[model samples]
Target chain A: MAAKKLNIKDKYRLLTRDLDWDFSYEDPKKAFPYEEFEGIKITDWNKWEDPFRLTMDSYWKYQAEKEKKLYAILDAFSQNNGHLNVVDPRYVNAVKIFLTGVSPLEYQAYQGFAHVGRQFSGVGARVACQMQSLDELRHVQTQIHAMSHYNKFFDGFQEFSHMHDRVWYLSVPRSFFTDARSAGPFEFMIAIGFSFEYVLTNLLFVPFMSGAAHNGDMATVTFGFSAQSDEARHMTLGLEVIKFLLEQHEDNVPIVQKWIDKWFWRGTRLLTIVAMMMDYMLPNKVMSWKEAWEVYFEEAGGALFKDLARYGITMPKYADVIEKEKEHISHQAWWTFYTHGHAAGFHTWIPSDQELDWLSEKYPDTFDKYYRPMWELAKEQEAKGERFYTSGLPQLCQTCQIPMLFTEMDNPNQNSMRDTVFDGERYHFCSDGCCDIFKDEPEKYVQAWLPVHQIFQGNCGGPDVGDILSDYYRMNVGVDNMDIKDSPDEQRWNKWKGVA
Target chain B: MSKVYIALQDNDESRYIVEAIEESNPDATVIHMPAMIRIEQENRLVIERKVVEEKMGRDWDVQELHINLITLGGNVDEDDDQFVLEWKQ
Candidate 1:
């Protein structure tokens, strides 16, 4: 059967215009909120044009191709003994954190995208959202499949579902996403879609891809880059939606600006985990967190905000806070990872001499001052064939779930701490932002999915690290096959570098 | 010289793509508006239909242009004669 040729204009009219229905029971202004936000007058919603020019068939075809390519990489990685070649077993900890922390969020994005596909009035948008929905699902599945290989050698791999519910660290991401989901559709677009996708995801995806590629994890590198190609489309959606809202009204400037301010900070805070993983967790670090921040945020963010300034939005309120924290967020998160390695899905071993030298070169300031001392302590223990552990629970922030190492605003030395008592129980927070979130709804905060609590509950499928590995490495996990530590790629990498 | 219009939903990546295209194709004049981008010049403006199809992994008709347009800042009206791109000043 011959496929019927589809017209672009008709597709546009059918998607955006034809799908919308007037609500007889409620005013359209109240339903849409386009008019009440500010002084913007949409003389015509039809004037909006989605520049990427996507259709349903094209969306599926490209998406399927992306998935096919990603799955092939996963297959090759596992079939070829990928795990043995890892720089160290400890590096698997980073991959585990990624699988547990991020992979599930991809599934959430898939669900959200489905909602967007249905709610968005435009056919083109609906199609695009459908593609994104599928893309997010693919990301979740592929990530789980790729990391499932290390389930044999890692700890903390089994209880992610429970961990996310009870772990203080997860509160950062959980709260951030919950905030977005609770808002009206437009606010969701601005918070998760535009602000995060456009402003921050590249900072994360690019470095992750580069690090995976550099360290000889071919499957991870390929998947990261492939997934990012779709992210470019989302970034465009974010940008277009913001502008569309802005052009729709003059008063939207402030409302939009508030969202940018709120989301940018929220997104930046959640990414401290990424920054640490990129800068400190990788066995072969690419760039310092400070450098990534300067390039991705200071340069790119500075330029972007400057452009938006012409539209009357100022730089976010907490821009300076981010600027100052860039120097230390990596150090703080890595310290937490190191201290909590025994409880984590991955291991944390002391860096080799070569790795130490590399760190000295990458991080001139704190690498020697703060990290070197800790490494020296770990090295002393390693000589005795022992590894370090904190032996107690970390004092987690009531809000962000991060340890209270983040310094006070503009005071890098004084640890930022806020305390509040509810029913005579003291609650600690790293920053007021998180405290405010907790204060707004203590009940929600109390129910956070914390990874630590799950371990105590014995719900992680095992009583010990060895047993947990077996359960988490089940067939459904997909990553059960490839071992990056001993893989051919890692062997080849070691041989090429003359590093045994 | 005739003009080419490009529209971008204002953000970093679309802006980066516009800049990248401009960097690669210097002769093509590019203009940015609040919503999309416009690229215009007479020098054989082609989307490399074969490459696009290969990347997408399927056949696509020329009329499905609006569906693929993720960002549109201005008007790119392709009629019987010339392709027209315009923005409100």
Candidate 2:
């Protein structure tokens, strides 16, 4: 018996890419339908390069380490009265939001990446897709396992899967990803790889890790940090994809330029939720959205755009949109958290006077001038034993499904409004494009499964507010009294508060 | 309209390239293909070797092209006929 050996290039060209063949009697575009719609050209598929020289053995080894680490944390949290260990039941609402808003996106990422693996024209891209698909699946499973520990002690945890599918806020993410999925593969690269991963993933991962660390959530911090480590590689892929497109064809520069404009705006709007969560949800906030933006986007990404200027492109069209909304997004989400948190799995209390001063110092430009008055009103309400919910369902922007808080392009104060008629019923949108999209397919947009509406309709498994909050959202009613728990950590926190 | 093709390492670099191009030409139209960015310029599109050379600096090598690119679409032609950079409109 004899063993045959293949050289590196030979193995790649022969075993991997060389095996692909043009199908007989089928249009190439149909076989690869997404490639031609936007009118970008590709004469040779072989020039693509795979940066990661990964093999199956290496892949499995790394994956196993990730799983072992994650499962251990889940076990510790489950067995050690982890729910009782938290600073407050309100703090657990952050976890509830994670379960409902973000965990499902991981599954969607897995499916989308699987399509990436199978449909990409380049072998390296296929490999990238494979790796990301697996990573996404891991994220989903890990998030579920970690959050499930609180399911016994909290409310809203149970209804997350259902809520994710039907909530107004949830529509933003679902629609955004669906838009990418509907596009050609190259557009997907632009939307997810370039726009989402490269420009914003750092913005996302850093906050998650930093906030978790600040809150003594070692498990979440560890998982987020680990995920961020992998994100760096994905970011590189995004950068490479953009460059390759421009260098590949002089014509491609402009086509990619449009996608950058469109998707950059789209992705930034979608990340409003992240911006709000980072700035508001945590009892111990780390970085303001403004500061994070300056460091991550302004410093790092702004420099990258400067370097890119030589290649004949500009910053995305809606760069100013993200910049302008920084203060408002966090402000609105905090308001939401402060008001609705009691009904959900989390708790919300007035910030200590010290925390208020800290906030003022952190947001010198706007906090004192604009927000302090609002906070004072809230405090007065709390003192009087009255809490406010804005009485009616908010008018969600069709594109982002955030309340229509975004002002005009430059005027951050003047409300932006757009409308479209669907099935002869007029719908208001915060932006023109969103209205247009809804108008194009009225049926799709009209069927939105809004979460607030569900709660009002008494669909969340309870006869009253307390029952629903406990059974569905997963709030702690009995075990530890939320912030004043039986844990040593709570004792220490209480003692520290007494000192000041 | 001329057709071109560019190959790069991944999509992020494709974005950099697109941004670079749009910086110079704001109205430029772009289309995305599986592994490339296709551009259709109403006028001419040029890639000054000196520009790439200057940015890459001492690390510049033609083979590094693979490390730098991820998008290839729209009127792109590079590396003789072996690689097509642009998609024909």
Best by TM-score: 1
**CAPRI class assigned to model 2:** incorrect
Q: State the lDDT of candidate 2 residue by residue for A10-30, as single tens digits.
A: 444553476566668886656
Residue-level lDDT tens digits of model 1 in A1-500: 89875555556556666766667898665554433343434455565666556556566776776677668867888888676666654465567667767777787778777775666544545666677788788887877777776554444466665555434455567666766766556677788788788768867776665666667676666566666667766776776677777877787788788778777877888899998788766777766677768756775556556556657878887688788777678767766666665444444445668877877787776578656777888778756866566675666676566667787655555788898877677788787766765776687667655444555677766675445444532322213223234444345446755786
Full-model lDDT, candidate 2: 0.61
RMSD of 2: 10.8
In the order shown, the chain A TM-scores of the predictions are: 0.80, 0.82
Error of 2 at A484 (Å): 12
Candidate 2 deviant stretches above 4 angstroms = A1-27, A82-85, A337-349, A408-414, A420-427, A431-500, B1-89
Q: In model 2, what lDDT does residue A277 have?
A: 69
lDDT of 1 at A99: 71
The estimated TM-scores of all candidates read: 0.73, 0.72
TM-score of 2: 0.72
Interface RMSD of each: 10.3, 13.8
